[model samples]
Target chain A: MKTIWFHLMPYPELPDDFTDEHRSVWVDIDPALFDARVGHRMYNEYIDELEFAASVGFDGVGINEHHSNAYGLMPSPNLIAAALARTCPDAALVVLGDSVALYNPPIRVAEEFAMLDCISGGRLVAGFPVGTPMDTLYAYGNNPATLRERYHEGIELILKAWTADDVFSFNGKYSKLRYVNCWPRPAQKPHPPIWIPGGGSVDTWEWCARVGYSYLYLSYFGYKAALKTMQGFWKCVEDAGRPANPFQAGFAQFFGVADSEAEAIELYREPAEYFFNRCLHVYPGFADPPGYKTLNTVRNGAEGMVERAAREANERAAQAAKKAERKAAQQSFSAASHMSFEQMVEKGYVIVGNPDQVAEKTVEMAKQLRIGHVMSLCHFGNMSRDLAMHNTELMATKVLPQIRHLWDDEWEDEWWPQPLPASDRVMPSPRPTVSR
Target chain B: MIDLAQWKAGSLEIWREGEGRTVGYLHGMVCAPGRQPFVTELASRGFEVVAPSLPGYSRTAPSDDIRNIHDWVFALSEIIDVAGLAGAPMVASSTGAMLALELAAVRPEAFSSLVLVAPLGLWRDDLPVADPFSTTLSGQRALLTKDPTTTALFFEDHESGDALVDATIQRYTARTATASLVWPLPEFGLSQRIHRVSCPVTLVWGSDDQIIDPSYADSFAACLRDVRGRHVVNGAGHLAEWDDPSAVASIAASALN
Candidate 1:
């Protein structure tokens, strides 16, 4: 299995009463709450952590994009990827990735990604995600009804820009460029490997299966909850009659590893609680705009229809039950926020244990799901620089070695980046390692 | 009696009633006009009513061709022509009124006159329009109408035989069309084109409208080339026609005559 270290780079210092007083952590989050001085230090600290993860011999280091959000601070993952490309030469620069539709002309992505691949010497895993509803629809002001359409068109335009030998005049519904040519074409042949980080959209699953791109399910609720979505993707692959190469899939999970289970719990409890509570405290109003969810996702099946019909017959009781149901559904994240650290562990929202235990759980999850890539989120909400280093180093020294050889003997990883030979590469100056 | 029929090769769902002079009706963000009391009242006033559901807002599925405000204006103009309501005095409400004005701005003679009820094509920095798409479903209902009865009758899921799935799809379809037109903000450069509407226009609003404030009646009246007058129906919200059907229909009928 290929283990990639991912960072969300959340703001570490929210007020103690932030959840009590604030309406949301995104979209309409209070601007006054953010301090630029703190952000400056935090950014460098985060970049340092990503470098540290790479230094500890992790196969890859990753970043992603989010807009108008406190957590996942890289609004432009490419900028951070550029920084990593120069310094972390051995580690794959995984940008899990740009929200393609947000760019005007979207060739900006093609240009920028190509530049990163060149700078990193052909080590770039380009992630194309249909952005979260909050980022794309609300913050970026893309119409929900046409967002997916624009996104699909944007991806087509980008892929064509990357590979077309001759300059082409493209007339698309959302964007039209008369002269289309991407300068400084990607270092990797036919562009970097495309990994789609998705949220269980059936259309995305089918598209990934058909296109032979890696489908990465970013698990917020952890591996147990991720079972259905991962199963759904494998089903799509099976139906498409494609090989069930584990490398075709990747899954993200939050991890907290230590010398002992109790130590792991103690170290990770605050950050885990902070992440589930505040970072995920998104306003329900900003979620799932009108056409953000497709009709297939919205419509209840025939059995559900019959059930709904019966429920409609007993209107008052049904309404009362529905109100309760809606409340529970809306509060699902908040419910996680309020959960004790023990509850989060039991639910598998966060995997916390000694190295052997953590490795065992990870291996069990990867094997069960037929996953070749395990994206480890070792640094999360409000975790200090020293503690984060401890988590990453322990995972690297003890945990990764145990799981790294899982799918290697049986399946080849065709999706990973193929960097140029080290002898031919331009090297940066080696910095003295920081002692924690 | 109102009849439901399909137009444009079964791609448009239209409601038609009465048998005299044609009065083209355009519906707002929520329900189709097939069973609205205002459409019934307008028909009883001795004029033919042709109400075509805006694409994706009713039984008609969303068309890929109609993607933006410009396409919407073109589509509405086509509907007006195909429904045989060209040069007829038009009655439009909310999101439909927004499209009606956009069409009139460019086509001019598309409608003989227009009685627009709380249209949502203008924005003010100080009094920004309340966004229905950015709020909860209950919050959207509250913004649409002031009366709980109207909310229950139209917005709530209380009908006996209707499947919840169908109702949910209906609501989502309506929202998709409406959001496509007016989401983020309703302003689609209508302020720049409002002066080009050659036909006379009568603006009406609910006194208690929250979506686009009733005060915006002045904003529209100020820019329109030929404004007959502006009327505010008391004890109503954005969907004034639903709250006080007789008052809204009477105002619309009087304006058209």
Candidate 2:
């Protein structure tokens, strides 16, 4: 199994009264609350943790994009990726990634991804997430109905820009570029590995399976809640007649490790509570715009599909009961809001234990979920640098080494970034193109 | 009570009522008629009201493919034909008024006269329109109707099981469809083209419209070539018809006459 150290990089100094006084922690967060001096220090410390993760032999160091968000300081993951490329030499810089649909001429995505791949000596696991409704529709002003359409077309345009042998003229629904050519093509031939971090969309699952890309279920809800989704993704892959390699599936889990179970709870409880309660305190209005979930998803996915099936079979009596149950299950992730340490442990929102126990539990969960790649957020919420570093070292040295050998002899892990050999790598230089 | 009419483009339901001279009533963001006295008052004044529930508002399928104002204009124009009001006077409210202004600007001959109530299209950097989507349910209700009693009288939540789910879906789908028109910001550059409307236009606004300020009515009235000036209804909010239906009817009747 390949282990990744993921950083959310939350601002830790929100006052105790922030929850009561503030309506949301995201888009409408008060700019006055941010301290620029603190921001500079946080950036350095966050990068240090990511670089440290790479140094300790973790397979990947990941950063993601979120705009106007206090929880995620990375509005632009490529900036962090570029910086990490210079320092963290071998580990995959998972730029998981720029919201492609947010760009006007999506050639911008191709250009930036190419730049990162070139600079990182081809160590880029390209992640294309159809960004959260908060980031895409509300914050950036992309139309909710057209966001996924733009995302679909943007990825198409980007792929053509990167791999096309000659310069091409492309006219798409959302983007029109007269000259679709990317200078400084990715060092990875064709492109680097593509991983889609889905919010459990059926369209996303099928697309990831149909094309040979890995699917990362970026769920805050633990394995018990995410089991159906992971099973659905594997089912889609099987239905597509593709091999069900565990490497093609990636899952994120919050894990805390200490010398003992009690210590682990004590060490990570504050940050866990802070994350579930404060970081995720988004306005319900911003969560789902009316047309944000597509008709296909509404009509074909789990709820819609099941409702239709039950109705067809004259099982209307059973449908309503199912719906009420489903609604409760969806809200289970909110256990983080004022969660007790025992609640976090029992529910598996965060796997907490001693080093050997955490390793044992992680391997068990990974085997059950059948995911070969685990993006472990060992440093979460407002976890301090010292605690985060200790957690990172423990996860890297204790947990990773024990389980990294899982499925290593059975399957070729093709979905991860292939860092080019130092002798073979050639970095591209910037040049001004003369316009005719 | 109005009868629900079905159309073929999708299994969409439209509301058609009253008789005499045809009046194309483009409803506000919602199509709730619970105790709303304007349609009856219009009928008493002898004007036939063809108030469409619109696609997505009445258990009808909205064209999921509509991504912008251009598509909306076409879909609404098709509805005008479906309602058989190719060239009738149009009374549009809120979001519908924005659609009407755009349609009238594009076609010029679509409406004989336009009665636009609290139309939501123009954007002012200095005087920003408050976002309705960002608010909670009670907060939005407070913005739409001036009297809290009026909201309770109409949208009484005494539903359970399937009825509750049905009502919830209907309300949400309508709002979702409206988001396509007004999502992040309500302005779709109708200010640039409102000048092109050829029909005589009357702007109606609630004096205390918290959702959209009544002051914007004058701003919009100024842009049209043949505007009949702004009419500010007293003691009303955004949905002025619900607050003071007879007053709205009086102004619309007097203007139409």
- Best-fitting candidate, measured by TM-score? 1
Q: Which pairs clash (backbone N, Cα, C closer than 3 Å) in model 1? A: none
The 10-residue segment of model 1 chain A with minimum total lDDT is: A301-310
lDDT of 1 by residue, B1-257 (tens): 43345555356677887777889889888654456788888888888888888778667657777678998888887777767778999999999999899998898888899999999899999899987877666777788888746756446775445477787788787888888987678888999998899999999999999888888988898899999989989999998998898899899888877
Of candidate 2 chain A, the 10-residue stretch with the lowest lDDT total is A304-313
Highest lDDT against the true fold, candidate: 1
Per-residue lDDT for A1-436 in model 1, tens only?
A: 9999999889888876675577667788889989999999999999999999999989999899998888878899999999999989799988989999999989999999999998998999999988888888888998888998998899999899999999998899999999999998998888999999987677787889988999998766788867877888899899888999999999999999999999999999999988876676666566757887777766622111112222222342345456657776553332323556787799897899999999999999898888998889999899999999999999999999999999888899999998777876788867889999
Taking all chains together, each candidate's TM-score versus the true structure is: 0.92, 0.87
Candidate 1 stretches with Cα past 4 Å from truth are A300-337, A429-436, B1-10, B151-154, B158-163
Indicate the worst ten consecutive residues by lDDT in candidate 2 chain B: B29-38
| Per-model lDDT | 0.84, 0.80
lDDT of 2 at A46: 95
Per-residue lDDT of A19 in model 2: 55
